[model samples]
Target: MNDCVAWSGGRPVEWLLTNAPVDKHWCTIHATHMTAEEATALAASGAVVGLCPTTEANLGDGLFPFEDYAGAEGNWGVGTDSHVSVSPIAELRLLEYGQRIARQERNIAAGTQDRSTGRALLEHAWAGGSQASGRSTGGLEVGQRADILSLNENHPVLVGRTGDEILDSWIFSGENTPVQNVMVGGKWVIRDGHHEREEEILDNYATVLRRLST
Candidate 1:
């Protein structure tokens, strides 16, 4: 897929789908230039669309037709393609915001059944990411890796927030990283908003940047 946008009027999508083996050669249809019909066809083909909202905006790429894509039940996931913004919350927030501005409506990413735009966006990204990464984990479940993030309920953005509101606030209102703890495969990697190897990692990163600057 290699960040595919509507090159050749989307003939590349048709050509790839036709030539590639089923379930073996999935694509990341970076779909800013794709039309509704093209998105629908890509969805029906079961390909994963890699959406990098922040990067798209930075590059002046056209807004992704999120409403149309979701309406077709498309398989899509968010990515920090350019590493300009590394947070998942930023990606989700910008994605929804772009849709709202384009459609001139609030909560545009919310599903027909679920009104929580945050929850819907999270679930969609989780499901699509699972498929995209070929990982058995995205959400909590038996036989899946226990990857979890604990939010700081005491944080100002999350004060008094509950249920889906917690997710909404975290994505839309939270400043910096609101994650208090992160557990990957049942192992604690981040505690109290700091990675266990923060100092060492930063030291090494700085060294690398210095060397590169020379």
Candidate 2:
């Protein structure tokens, strides 16, 4: 898991930090083999580890040592690296679940905040992903990009939830998402739970699958 030669040019995290010759972010993507020294060095380097728990589990990759890295105040973000599951909920849910299973303890990602695990996951992932990409995302601030996801607050799964509870429900709940609307770059792309080109996109996808099968 900590195959520095496989992932990088065998540059240790500390060397990369002081020499500034390579980006350490690529080396820690799945730091399963990383030592405590490497973890601390990468954490101090201000690089975000792009974690894709669902894909990692799907491919039987060794579980990441999330507790140790997080204990070092490492920055991380979630992703769907292999497109195994496109839903961010699935990614986040698995990320936490994997840690819980490995440690035999629940709420491993929440740290000291026992009740707000989901909230912490969402916020950190959002912020880390933004930082990694160096984009003006991850917030609703006026100058930020207008990428917004609106959940159906009236959905049965979230009916009585409030505040971070709503976020928790949307992420940890089942796959049937409550996202009824989406806006990207200040334009409405999906509304009332339907994309404008939903049928066309499906047809095109089906055509490609059919051709590949033939």
Clashes of each: 0, 1
What lDDT does the true structure give each of the candidates? 0.79, 0.79
Tens digit of per-residue lDDT, candidate 2, span 56-127? 777787777787789998888877675648877898898888888878888777886557888889888988
Off by over 4 Å in 1: 1-10, 22-25, 112-114
TM-score of each: 0.89, 0.87
User: What lDDT is reached at residue 89 by model 1?
Assistant: 82
Q: Which stretches of candidate 2 lie over 4 Å from their true place?
A: 1-28
Model 2 backbone overlap count: 1
Compared with the true structure, model 1 gives a TM-score of 0.89
